[model samples]
Target chain A: MCTGSEANDLALRVAKQATGHRGVIVTENAYHGVTTEIAAISPSLGGVGSLAEWVRTVRPPSGDGTAMVADARTAIAELQAAGHGVAALIVDTAFASDGFIAPSAETRAALAAVQALVRAAGGLVIADEVQPGFGRLGARGAGSGAAEASLWGFPRHALEPDLVTIGKPMANGLPVAGLVARRDLMQAFGERVRYFNTFAGTPVSVAAARATWDVLHDERLPEHAADVGDELRGMLAELAGRHDRLRGVRGSGLYLGVDVVDPESGDPDTPAAVALVSGLRERRILISASGRDNAALKLRPPLPFSRADAERFITELDGALGDLG
Target chain B: MCTGSEANDLALRVAKQATGHRGVIVTENAYHGVTTEIAAISPSLGGVGSLAEWVRTVRPPSGDGTAMVADARTAIAELQAAGHGVAALIVDTAFASDGFIAPSAETRAALAAVQALVRAAGGLVIADEVQPGFGRLGARGAGSGAAEASLWGFPRHALEPDLVTIGKPMANGLPVAGLVARRDLMQAFGERVRYFNTFAGTPVSVAAARATWDVLHDERLPEHAADVGDELRGMLAELAGRHDRLRGVRGSGLYLGVDVVDPESGDPDTPAAVALVSGLRERRILISASGRDNAALKLRPPLPFSRADAERFITELDGALGDLG
Candidate 1:
């Protein structure tokens, strides 16, 4: 496949075949991709009401994360009652669209529980790692030169996914994406259908991915992101101490977010977020708002962002917040 | 869009919105693309039985082409009775998947009538020009220098399509494809939904398409295809006279197809096509089989194919056919 949507679509198809079911479960405000079937499951694109009947949405794990277990249980029961038994519970482990929640111990446990629950109900687990793969979250390797423990987000939650989808950053702007599935599931689907795409796995695309991977590993970009992200998050936290409008500074590695709210009411202030983003734009910085109400600033800078770049962004953000006032 | 499937999918979305209907009509063996929605309308991928309830299939025009009008009328009535009404009739004007029929005068007139009928019923006509666009059918410009009469297939039939989908060869081999639509339909869909894709219209993709277009025009590749295709067809016809298994040497420009048949029974010979194709591969030539029975040799050479190249191919084909005996 050449796009993330196609990979996710194929993932669901294989999962459905493996599970012998038709229903799917995803986070309420999740974004998978832009293909027809994948788009129907991406509530962030058109809201949950626009989702297909076979798709059920659950709240993303927040706080202690146990609440999402209950949500999944309810969703599973409802799908069972509708006679569309669960085929898969697909998740963007970064939770980027649900306001970029970092996985706490409780959230990880909850995710593990949900994975077990879905499997027990004959559903597979699909980890949409498009956002959190390729060392975007943090260092998967333990030492500077040792073998990496894990570069994928799902491994952190200790969940063994049946299917893992990766895209976008794999080839550093080239169109390349794929679905990595269990051997048994892949064999089963391969026996039934032959898949071929004219633009898939082209020589240039593969070469680009290989070059990017070599550079990423040689430069230790993931470790750099982790170090710089930690430093940047601390700077933002300090800035939040001075700016009452900025709240809830949280994220992992370079993918971070902070809520823009009304100082007096503490409610999401979309206008404030918009104004801050515009103000930053004037200062030659670029960022975007994400989540349901579009009040959380999604600060996913490039993987190679350095500490100096982080300082410049923090400095500009400080001025932008002050200008917004 | 980065693939033809995405472009066709978007075309359908716009058409369905424009007509406020859901039914789609396509040729019985037509192939649009591989996306979920588009694949359902592509009977060449699966059988017509795999079509969605909102879809109807009509036979491709063969002899005089008037028979397709009756098929369209019946399909339109069935869709209306099923309450799907008619959203669009998408046709690959080249009819590549229906065994690559050249546009005859009667078939052209029948297409015009079907277009009128579809419009009168409040449906749009979509020209899927992926196979026949960009001068594949011959020199759109008369006399090699005058402004091109028409570079697209639909204009050759004097049909004004509501939407046209193009892909694959647009940027040579790079991933670039798009949908051209009537202004009002695009406006209606745009007002309701904002479309965005991560890799669409990237600078590199745009540059690639522009470079390819420049080379195509500078070298007069379309005119070359026209000249070479004519000579090639004549050579194949001459060969067909000697080899009973070679029949129906028909097509336009460089996109040609010939039926591989049993000499004694005059029926499609899949094994013979397989053997001929495999034998050609052994001779370092490449070709493929098309049509439902996989018995028609699809001869879609590059636009730059010259008279010399055509002669070489004919020589090999003559030997291959003789070897078949």
Candidate 2:
């Protein structure tokens, strides 16, 4: 539970070795982890660790999603030309560091587009499924979101990832994570390399993981997450409409981001975010201000959060923001 | 439980980086671990890794005390001439692979002699405390034998091991291990190179370690280990006197190795060792063969074992060996 950083770095290493590439292309506001290799690639957590060479950080697509994709494509081409065998195009879904922003399909497609370019350049594709995995952010019940959103999603795997690294909230601080790759890729990886972690893949952790998944599925927590998320987002958006300092609110499912801004300029207003978090903590809630000059307050609670709980949280947040007026 | 081979290889990477040396000095027949690095140094463990050009194996002295130390000193000189810088001296304590044989004080001092040579050469001293740590094997009543022995007997913080790794029996097969280091050296290692482990310092593991240590101390397992060890050794010795194939036995307190030899030639017998282990296992009493030719049968029981338990085991082993005869 210390961080999701190590697993991300190992993922990069395995991809680099497997694909025989030195360059890693990551999202602009990406916060994959806080390790040297990851931080270098991660624009947000870069200061968290020493950034190394061969990590090409690219802008995660913005409001102008088309331009964002173009920026990433250009960045990938430059790094490839600079002799960095583009290893893997990695993207962190439910980008917590980037205002808890869920990328639009165009943004995701553009990201996927760059990945396609890397694959064309003989690179692998790695997905950071740390968050938004295990059915947290998308469809509520049994139906898959991409499948319901489009025929492509419902029919089969949407983004056929070469490797997937996951951690955080898997077992609610139980500290169990893993990397899932295509069987053939794993076999190739195992040709001469053997990987065994003393702690990871232990029976106890496996039990915890299985049990956590069972608990989540049995309770249908994702549905509850969606309902609560919608409630919380509406409440926060309404509060922002009432308060000029509150600029925006957005997210998918339970993980939401409330962007507080300067009353006069609408520029990222961080002090008010700090004030809100501190006030909320005083009321016995636990959270932190991160993303967007700490102006964006990220709210990610444990699964199985009740709708009433969301209502209560929104009530408290509304009251807190009202005091700012 | 992974193979014993990989464990040693991981240790080697840290050893080299910590010592900043290209050459590793491991005693002959010392089972460092079961990875490529360890297998190459192990003299036996079977398949070897791409043996990096940095390791220099040394012979632990025979018969004469301290000659092992002399051998290590000479080994250091040889390594330097061959362009391998002395990184650290790794000892498996009781070369259990060689019948739980311990280097004499002269040998220890001679090995300790390299302390200066390697230190001047900016090296480290690592003791593989996997077997002897955790008050098992008749160590101190409170802490590991090495910790107790080194803290009091060896010069205070002498050798100042850059890394002292201990595992097995620490959590009673709960899968927990650690490297206790001098705080400053640990800091230096961390500063120079970061080594982060996901499961190494988990909360449950921390609790397990604390509880395990408590059980060892509160139950006086170490004291019992010494008592039962003395009884077991004495009984085995007595049995050896009657059995012609039994040459001798060696060990500290609990962790004993019963040496076997050919009756006619009075030479170490390898076949008897394997047969003896197989015999014991058939009786549902688990014990493994160790030392040269697998000539010594390893007797490592839980610390809480009793004289009655030892007697029962001895009876079973005796009956098994008798059947073999």
Name the candidate that leads on TM-score. Answer: 1
Instruction: RMSD for all candidates, in order, please.
Output: 2.1, 6.8
For model 1, state the Cα shift of residue A308 in Å: 1.0
Q: Please report the interface RMSD of model 1 to 1 decimal.
A: 1.5
Stretches of candidate 1 off by over 4 Å are A143-149, B143-149
- The whole-model C-alpha lDDT of candidate 2 against the native structure comes to 0.65
Q: Can you write out model 1's per-residue Cα lDDT over B263-305, one digit (the tens) per residue? A: 9999999999998998888878999988899998999888998
Best by lDDT: 1
Chain A accuracy as TM-score for every candidate: 0.96, 0.89
Looking at model 1, residue B275 earns an lDDT score of: 89
True C-alpha contacts between chains kept, each model in order = 0.35, 0.05
Per-residue lDDT for A144-186 in model 1, tens only? 5432645677776767889999988898888888999889999
